[model samples]
Target chain A: MPARKSAQPAKPAPDSTRRSEKSRRAIYEAALALVVEVGYPKTTIEGIAARAGVGKQTIYRWWSSKADVLMEAFLDLGEQSLREAGPVPYAFPDSGDLAADVKAVLRATVDQLRDPRFEAPSRALAAEGVVNEHLGRELVAKLMQPSLDLYIGRLRAAQDAGQVRPEIDPRIALEFFISPLAQRWLQHTGPISYEYTDTLVDYALHGLAPR
Target chain B: MPARKSAQPAKPAPDSTRRSEKSRRAIYEAALALVVEVGYPKTTIEGIAARAGVGKQTIYRWWSSKADVLMEAFLDLGEQSLREAGPVPYAFPDSGDLAADVKAVLRATVDQLRDPRFEAPSRALAAEGVVNEHLGRELVAKLMQPSLDLYIGRLRAAQDAGQVRPEIDPRIALEFFISPLAQRWLQHTGPISYEYTDTLVDYALHGLAPR
Candidate 1:
């Protein structure tokens, strides 16, 4: 839900809006830090409110559950990372050269993965998601699906350009670029680097078998 | 360590050996069950001993820590699954058709991932491993490395047989076959099926680009 767009009307006054934004940012920070310090189960809405220096009713007024708050907090974190990386558009690049464009995107992903602020909380939530199927699906739907859609869109363009095979399923094909890095990070299977991701893109685009 | 080999001498008497084996099996079962029920941190040697109806000293005598015991128990579970699958050699199959051999192996893996006995405890351990780097590396080194090695061996053989590109690094190339399936299972990203795995093999070997 990071790039969600909706029409807004009946906005609050400027002073109240500023205050609300401040409180919201505080809540996001507190929720992320709390999840990292103590895990998902122990991170309560009340605890987040306390850490954020707000009332419990304030959090309840917004998110219905701890999971809701945490998911939003994660989305906000991704946006923050993107902002820090500069004012880049929120679409996968399509430079006509499929390999170069994908490599550029994956290199950016490598930087994001190595970001310490992103690493701890991401792992905490991801660990919980592994065992909690409900939250796992929610994470995929809300957090992952958008990024996956970008990959799909770019691959479709590649197919149109006669770069990728028209018959290739973009959904499964995207996994070849991302899943290896994910498995290595999640399972400690191996080290991750720009070179590793570049290699993944290469292997994925070109067959492992001889051409 | 399912296919671990070691020289054995100075064996115990048959009766004592039988009793030891019975007790060891019980400990493994108890450990696996406890982890699934209450999770990794709550599981302890005392609890496993009580559940297994053995002295704490018995668990201590064989294993030094809960992680140690759990790793061995998982290895045992894997061996049990293999035994039930019929007597097959521990090496990766080499029929010269890399795609068929890999697909066959991944199909068996899909079955194992879906097995009732393997599912719960494996999830519990995997969930913990995501957050705990120490335990995560141990899990990879002891439980997963063997299977990865098998894939590496098969890929290397494919290279030798000129079925694969000589320059492709088998270590990373093998991830194309397994990591997609792993991500689906671990993250609930997609449904896993024989058809899905077969497609992965086909895509991996044939490349995503048109020939």
Candidate 2:
């Protein structure tokens, strides 16, 4: 769970609950918009509050720092993306055919990356992370680590099935599936497509050298 | 060649040439420092000139814009790094054993990425490129493309030697060598070291699947 989630859940009346939900959504939208517009360094809580039509104290009430707000906002955005992708409780697909399962996940990622709502704010935050080491590590730990864990879990399953080499480090092995696509997307090195991701899966699983 | 390279070579008097060389080195240092300190958007030609103790006209005489100056500065820095690595004419070594050759190149790259002078300025520029599509494309074209080409060439050579599958696209195949390292360096996803990179080579060359 995110560190900022309230330890004691507030039990409020229906009207107050609805109002808080509305305010929270507005804050998320405002934070994402501000980061996309002004970039991360120039984005302030005051600006987010003003844009959200909420008081600064309200933002402080929920989150301790701008980083916290932005991180949570991004997490919300990712959740929204996952929900749009399908039903609740998305798990990394493990159909026993490791290649097909990984390809499906990577295809979904390509779709998420191409989403207009996710692209701009994500690029802004990712760009900041590239230069800001503290923020970069925070992004890795908070934003990316969960997905990485899923990849590692799936790989472990493949290992158990005798589909993957047991001695292989899933951590580094997983990069071949994601990093190329990421470099292409973030650096504008090449076009991203399902076919491209499928190729990554093939190359990573089967090896580039003749089998 | 970079677009800004002079079409005609200038023949200047020896004393004048020495003065120009000194001024050029100062400008390159100033541009890199400004980008690292103030970032790309805030870095101006006036700022670079002021720092370099040169007039704005001196900058305008050689480069059309700040982008040109920065790109040339980075190219110069890369050459300096290559020179420091050893004697000139650094070719991608093809020692029959493709893995050993690629590993050596990647190790040298690790050294370059860890260089104090290269790291900050490179991170600053790469961060800017992530958000700025046009600049990102330019960076890929002018800075990364040559290195990518060398990788492609080496992979092609390996294919000819039957070390790699002839059916594999060299372009995508090469990403397995570089993108993981690039992602780790740019995003702080993992610790970078010769060992980590060597492991990547082994995993990539030999399939992660039990062979």
Candidate 3:
């Protein structure tokens, strides 16, 4: 049900594009803040509209549901982080040093996870996704899959470069790098620091078994 | 607050022990079911007492709060799972074949995660823990630490056996094995299966680098 696809026109007028971008950013910020403050079940289209200072019709015009808006909001947040980091969208640096590249990207992720602007809203949405199956699945499909694809792509590159073993599944191997950090951040299981994540990257890539 | 040691006797007489065990089991079932049905915030001592058909005094006689009751309930659940698996209490097996033991334990965990009786109640508590920092910390300290200790103990044994790298931190290395499965289970990020966990164990034990 979340897989609705509507192709937009190849190009829009310059003014229209700018206006649309503005509306989109506003909607994202509003949706994230509302969910953080009032929680998921209580956040609504009307609330997002009112907070964003846009009419209900404008939001309804773009996204079908508040879930859709929040998903896109998160996607935007990732892109914004990338832009701030002075990268072209999202790309795992292929410096040909697999371990260094991974550590660099994970460090960036740690910054994003710790960013006050991102933390509360992300936690709120993530909390809701835990209990709400439909929303949870949609989140995986929209927000998470892209980031996962980047990991897959990087691992594939590593495989080609003979850095990673060919027999290893990129999907599973990637989890060894990210999931530990995620668990610490989400569950307060342990302290997350550069040293901690750097250690995870090393342990994951080099194997816990002896060299 | 979670560290408060109850003044109750560690081991009561046989008659009282039997009576206490019965009351404890009832409280655990009531707490798990109530949290699943109504969630953590709404679940109260009085509610658990009413649902378990036990008096409020019965709950207070052993545990101090609803949080304490829920924590013990999860511990009991883990112990029950261990008993069913034919393990004495709860422990990670050390057969000197680290891979085989880890795989077996992980597979059992996969089964437990998928169990309907375990899933709902655990999710209910976990969902609340995500948003409530105080409760989340308490849950980790009370419920999660014991299982984590088992993992740490096993890793230490592995270190002694030379199955693991001497320099690796057991705490961090354990995350590579446990956190991925946990993230997938808790966040619905991906499918959880025996094959998946086995692969994780293999990846963590062996370096992902070209051997």
Candidate 4:
């Protein structure tokens, strides 16, 4: 009877909502820090709960598992970075200039990749994802797909504008601009810089073969 | 003094050499199996020794670290694969058709990547390399660079033959052909197939824009 009553309680006040937001932020921070320090395999929901000073039930009420928590944390971090960058949150700009817009977003991505605060945690998660197929697929679907959709959106705009050829699949065409940079960053295959990415943009847009 | 004398004993007989080869194969198999079973971080020299029916001293005598052992194991696996495929070991064919050569090599890579025997262990090491910068860089230098050099050699041949534009940096240009395929495989971004790779070859050799 008591459990049923608690479950059917009225909505919380604004103050309680504020408190909930604070707990959420704390949980996110705890999850990211734990993953970076102990690695993804060792990070646990209990650890996040203890570190966040929240109950395990509080986390269970919100997310299903540690992977869910970590994925949301990463998404929140990306949003925060975007907000701090002083742009419209999460929109790939379309100023009717496909090349410039892509170059701009990619340059920002290069900055984010090199940022010390983001690099370690991202690397930890990505490393785990590489070997864990289920986690990898989930990360791609939940965290990465949104960003990729933005690229696809922009590419479609380019195609509509007659800037990108209509025959090209936006998904495949987008890889030419992004994957090289990603491969270099993830694998340490080469040095990453705005100049290098800018070159990639030029080559991808203009094509490698003689026009 | 007796131990030193034993260590400096006379040259091995033909039978002893055959036994040594068997031991070497056993060690390589053990190392690969351990890495695939337990992952790179947990797979140690001692564990590999136990699995191989070898002493720690044997591993130490042959290699300095597990990384060295695994790297050599992977190199050996690559060589064996090449030999079994009935191809000349370690050379990218240059038939004076740059596009055909690139396609042929990439197709072979596709087969290698799909092979179940190679995939699991390779993923294990590659996943480790993503987070371990030192190991990642070393992997690139030792294992990947040899293959990359083959691409560079082929591009140079193309330039000489007036098929590829000489002004284009082969290193940067090569990324168009390789990085997209790699990212697809590593990240599960898209499907990989002969038709897709062949399209990459055609698109790369000719500019995307109308001539």
Candidate 5:
């Protein structure tokens, strides 16, 4: 859940760029707040504008729809999360230990998932996505897919190092590690912790059967 | 999901018991249909009664809340799913090959997930559970926990037979096989298939690392 906010200003006059940035932040904050308060169905662009202290036309000038605004807002929040989480720098750390590296990333993800600021709104959007197929796809494509691609890159690196099986599909194999955590977080199926994630890394890399 | 439905008859008089059974079946069908049509929030006892061609008094006479009614209805649907699928009953097949057995069951689950009768209403209830924490816990405790216990039992059996490692937590280990499929169904992250599930079984048991 990392953000690459793409709310680019068409032309950046210095003062105007500062103004646009301010407005963008306000809109992102307001959009997330409204979605949490009213849910996806009732979260309208007008509502976001009202909460953000901007005109609906101001929102329309930037984002095409409520979905676009919320998506970018979430992206911004993810970047904010990365910033707050300190020098992690939003990239998978490769210390040449696949288990240690994956565990580090997952532990950070656990922190991100547990962060109170991210939790409620993330749940609200995720819950909405369960029933709303189109929005769900967008969530995966924009918010989730990037992180997934990163995992794929790291896993491919592991394979080249002869750490992971070369024949394994990183996409599917990655799910063995991430999906369990995702499900527990998403479905209330179980509690998540650093220990749980570390165990997942160990389990994913080693066969469950007797060695 | 297993339903140990508590929709028992107050009186056991022969004709009364027969009538109660008929009403129970009608209520289950009605509740399931209503949820799929209008979702959990809009589905009501009154609406279920109207659809099932029974009295609201009849529904209330058995179940306490819409959540109860729907949970029981789903339990019944699960049982119905079992019967239609085969005469294996609902028990996990203990063929002594843990991989083969789990693969078979997950494949069956994939089929059931795709079934028209189960798909819409299951999605409706699941979507509701995602947002409603109270309902979500009830979903896990009542509907999901029983089925999970079955998996635990099977894994434990595998442990005793030297199939699964003894130190492994069946609970977490089970997630590898189930959560991926659950996430796919809930989030539309990917398509589910027999081959996909079979691979999940294989990857889960064997590990992602090179042998």
Candidate 6:
């Protein structure tokens, strides 16, 4: 779907398929790098092409705009992250201990956040999304929703097992697990650590009032 | 401090004090209008000056940059909101009921978020802050700090009365009340309303766990 937006049908000729794959990857990496260095507004296909050492025609032949390239680039980064997170990382662990499983996932999230490759571009994209409604919704739909769905699935499982109160809406409940960390990173309000995420998980699972 | 940033020391020459006040108000309105319309990047001192129908020198005589002008305008907006909230609005109601007090303040926040005068410009500035770290921090200090301190104070009172866990960090605990709502607005994830905020209050206080 994103490639459809990119207008790149991956017309991998039966011959130049290897070359096409190389060019596509080079474009994604270059787009991510440029966005981080110069920001989204200042970045362009020309800039990405020059940086990637590919011709502008090659870029135009595939992608429609800088936004499309960047979106797909970020998606690629996320896919890479999932691959790095070990096999089946997207599948939330159901150790039948909801709190521990959530904590484990959040801790992994903490590690990914600390990873420098993701930090700068993410900040740039998130910052732009804050101002740009179209881009913001696109990010929520393309980048954020899949991960959110995974959380929803895990929470539903917890509800079925009676680990969570049946009355709670999993979508909103998931915010406690993720939004705090997201806000801290976006706002620079606090340091992120395993400790902070673990605390959020605990506070979220147990009543903050006297138990 | 903000007035200092606005560079408008109250020295209002005995003769032009009223005129000065009028000009300052016009400048604030113009700065806010321009930012909402053109966004922070395109909003210029020159544009604000043109829009306000004042000479460039008039703006130069007061604020230093577009950021300073916008900051003062936002501060003015916050003041107007407080005024509308009635006298002593800054005081979070204690009434020996933490949940009720927090809910009251959050509901007021919901109204403020929905206010047309606040929403567009606020979103514009908030979006910029996400990408611009310096502006982001300044916003937290100038716009967010006083309200945050109020939350801290009220939570401290709750802790002293043993209403909340003595070990709970109010700073972190308070996010449960606001960050989810903030994310919902910033990310376009869901609808915001008194009913939704009330649910957040209930969830954050009682928590997702069975009591």
True contacts kept of each: 0.84, 0.90, 0.85, 0.56, 0.78, 0.69
lDDT of 2 at B179: 96
Report DockQ per prediction, comma-separated: 0.85, 0.88, 0.78, 0.61, 0.78, 0.62
lDDT of 6 by residue, A1-211 (tens): 3345345445667667777778889999999988888778789999999988899888877778888888889888878988986786557788999999999999988988888888888888887787777888888997889889999999999899888899999999999999889888787666899999999988888867877
Give the best candidate by lDDT: 2
Docking quality of model 5: it rates as: medium
Identify the runs in model 1 with alpha carbons over 4 angstroms from their true place. A1-9, B1-11
Task: Considering only chain B, report the TM-score of model 2.
Answer: 0.95
The residue ranges of model 3 lying beyond 4 angstroms of the native Cα positions read A1-23, B1-23, B54-58, B87-89
Off by over 4 Å in 2: A1-10, B1-10
Tens-place lDDT per residue, model 1, A1-211, is 2112333236769987788789989999999999999999889999999999999987877778889889999999999999998989999987789999999999998898899999999999999998999999999999999999999999999999898998899999999999999999999999999899999988898889888
- A67-137, model 4: which lDDT tens digit per residue? 98898898888888878888566689899988789899999999999888789889988888888878888
Residue-by-residue lDDT tens digits, candidate 5, B1-211: 1123354545569997677788889888999988877778899999999988899987777777889999889988888878876678778889999999999989988998899899888888888777787898899998889889999999999999999899999999999989999999999889999999999989889898888
Q: Pick the candidate with the highest DockQ.
A: 2
The candidate maximizing TM-score is: 2
TM-score of the A-chain for all models? 0.94, 0.95, 0.88, 0.92, 0.93, 0.90
TM values, all candidates: 0.95, 0.97, 0.89, 0.93, 0.93, 0.89
Tell me the tens digit of each residue's lDDT in model 3 across A77-169. Answer: 877777887845566788899999999888988999999888988888888888788888988888888789999999999999999999999
Question: Model 1: iRMSD?
Answer: 0.6
lDDT of each: 0.90, 0.91, 0.85, 0.83, 0.87, 0.85
- Which ranking of candidates, highest lDDT first? 2, 1, 5, 3, 6, 4
- Residue A67's lDDT within candidate 6 is 84
| Model 2 error, position B111 (Å) | 0.3
Model 3 chain B lowest lDDT segment of ten: B1-10
Q: Give the local distance difference test score of model 1.
A: 0.90
Residue A208 error, candidate 3, Å:
1.6
